[model samples]
Target: MDGLFLLSSYAVKDAILIRPFSLADIQSVMEIQSACYPANLLEEAEHLIAKHQQSPLSCWVATEHQKAIAYLLTHPWSGDTPPALNTPLPPKKPKSDIYFIHDLAVLPSARGLGLAKRLFDTAIDWAKQEKLQKIRLIAIAGAADFWIKQGLSPVNDKTLSHKLDDYGSDTHYLEAAI
Candidate 1:
């Protein structure tokens, strides 16, 4: 169950594929983000573009019929606190031991096709290959439960809990050991 998995029988034959993000995919990535998230939750196009530029290897995009339909943006990070959402990533690249998942999104029509899970699997594979210690993310949009089911747990550090509040009332910081 790795590398270009079949996304159920509902999709067009061989239409789905996942690959690392490229500078050329920025426009499609923005459209997908807008379609998948509310304005308050969405990152600015400039920030998203900067993230990809900063961590090209960590960001991934999913395509159907060679058209962008979904994406997952990740980066190297440390510490128990997740980065604040919708903000610019730091310019310096660290020798990372942790993989921080920034965003994962799929268009409405692509739901139920297991695209998210596929992207998750890809990230896990990348983390394992990179010898990262853990994967961390801020689970919003009621996605905490979904991450829990995938074996991630809500962080319990009292100090980090305060920082998670910036993401919104229901945001939860989650992590999975590698």
Candidate 2:
């Protein structure tokens, strides 16, 4: 559960395997990204790959029938402000007790099956295993409620608001203690 390759089987309508993401899963991840996010929010392959390369243990995919249906992208970070969208995380992030959840997406067809929560649990499990202090993420558009359900409260910080313009309006920065 702590490592990237640890797989969890969910007994949903269709059997889903929550497993580590690989470079080969990029296209399927993109399809899910397109289905879940707007053009401006969809991440490029290089950015996704960069995050995986930098922190493979923090990234994972939910696969059904050997195809990616959902994914969670996370990486260690040292700040309150999240990184820029559509860009690879810069090397040498400051040392801190937190990690940034860059993105989480599930295919429309896979909704209502609890795939989102399952993927989220994987990331949370990792955080707990690592003794991480916090989990930070941006709740884009209509995602605030879902994140709230996961125990993250909206963070009212000026640095985050000014830096998140590329993430569009209605984005809320949220964080929760692990």
- Give per-residue lDDT, candidate 1, residue 91: 62
Taking the tens digit of each residue's C-alpha lDDT, what string does model 2 give over 1-178? 5443333333444577888999899898889999998888888888889989988988999988777899998988886668888886879555668878888998888898898899899999998987889989988979989999999998878866787888888889999999
**lDDT measured at residue 86 in model 1 versus the true structure, 0 to 100:** 71
TM-score of each: 0.88, 0.89
How high is the lDDT of residue 124 in model 2?
A: 90
> In candidate 1, where is summed lDDT lowest over 10 consecutive residues?
2-11
In angstroms, how far off is 178's CA in candidate 1? Answer: 0.8
Residues 89-152 of candidate 1: C-alpha lDDT, one tens digit per residue? 7665467777888899988889898999999999899888889998888898888887898899
Model 1 clash pairs are: none
| Error of model 2, residue 124, in angstroms | 0.8
lDDT of 1: 0.83
Candidates in order have lDDT scores of: 0.83, 0.85
Please list the residue runs of candidate 1 whose C-alpha ends up more than 4 Å from where it truly belongs after superposition.
1-12
